[model samples]
Target: MAANENKEYSHKFDECPTCDGDLQYQNEADAECLNCGEVFYHEIRANRHLLWDYDELGWMRGVVSRA
Candidate 1:
């Protein structure tokens, strides 16, 4: 089997397709383009477990919570 055969395949758009701007993670299932203000949504699998939260100071905190 290929090295990536067991890994779950997910596509991430690192840059904006229209303007080539930097992309920021808006949430677990969405990302936004910094320069062009474009938001992109992705489908997250139910078995793929990941969670993120924000503190009072607006810093991102990543947690692995599976349900």
Candidate 2:
């Protein structure tokens, strides 16, 4: 019996390699962009689920307070 430790998988997303624009999720864990016609590949290393989901107002307030 062998213990497996490899869990991380490489993830590829259709992202713009020039401007780093928002990569839209296509369907099969892949993304494509029609803006700049750029392609990219990524890997899933760490996944951090957001707990405190905030809106624009909350984010702005947070920035102002920090400043």
Candidate 3:
């Protein structure tokens, strides 16, 4: 994958706090408001860089199947 491309898909939500519009989740915990351009952090950690990078953490999710 390229520097910009990520193996895992980051979640996105639309919800604006200032304008009560839409907020998009930039990463696991950070969200940005589409209308007001506000940023919200759900889970605050001491080391932010370490938490967001999945490759650094070596997190792997198993596949799911529907019967």
Candidate 4:
């Protein structure tokens, strides 16, 4: 088995589960479906590191401090 086989996998939904619309990034932890206007909020992490912080409207905000 590969070294990464036991690691958790993080994925982004290509289509919205609610409406099957194209998912677009609204912010760091939020996404919106273009067709149905459905919004999704989730924290995505990879390689045991935080990829982005959860924010409703943090497009301009800097990196979030975890301390």
Candidate 5:
């Protein structure tokens, strides 16, 4: 994975997208919801800036081309 791509843009999720609550990020690949306890995973593809691709649990929400 191109780790540098992530450094190009610094991002912090303000609230949990699933429950609209607080979020505690374990790392770059993990996001845990403080309210619902839902864990979401994301990937930083090669040469792509997709901040998030799904809502939760495989829900096809958005391909979001950029951060």
Candidate 6:
């Protein structure tokens, strides 16, 4: 471990606030604006680790299909 390795970065955004379009969930941890080319990712926690935000609407489809 290095002394300079201790840092926490935060990206408190998961959607394109500029584009007024529905966010298309690319997977479990990624999303993109269908209208614009803007991209967004999961938020970084206090440990500077990225944790994914899941789409509830998208997950519903998977559950229904598996049934």
Q: Please list the C-alpha lDDT of all candidates, in the order they appear.
A: 0.53, 0.34, 0.42, 0.50, 0.60, 0.43
TM for every model, in the order presented, reads: 0.46, 0.30, 0.40, 0.45, 0.53, 0.40
Worst 10 residues of 6 by lDDT: 58-67
Candidate 2, 4-53: lDDT as tens digits: 21222223333354455656654433344567543333323245211111
Q: Looking at candidate 2, what is the lDDT of residue 20?
A: 58
lDDT of 5 by residue, 1-67 (tens): 4786567435656476656888677887666778988665555556443545455467746643344
Span of 10 residues, lowest total lDDT, candidate 2: 58-67
Best by lDDT: 5
Residues 1-67, candidate 1: write the lDDT tens digits. Answer: 3555334324455666547788687654666779977555444356453333334565554432322
Model 2's number of clashes is 3
Candidate 5 versus the native: TM-score?
0.53
Question: Model 5: which residue pairs collide?
Answer: none
Q: Candidate 3, residues 42-62: lDDT per residue as tens digits?
A: 432232221121222444222
Span of 10 residues, lowest total lDDT, candidate 1: 58-67
* Better candidate number, 3 or 5, judged by lDDT: 5
Clash pairs, model 2 backbone: 11-42, 11-43, 14-31
Best by TM-score: 5
Give model 3's TM-score versus the native structure: 0.40
Those runs of model 2 whose alpha carbons end farther than 4 Å from true positions after fitting are 1-17, 46-67
Query: What's the lDDT for residue 36 in model 6?
Result: 76
Error of 3 at 41 (Å): 0.4
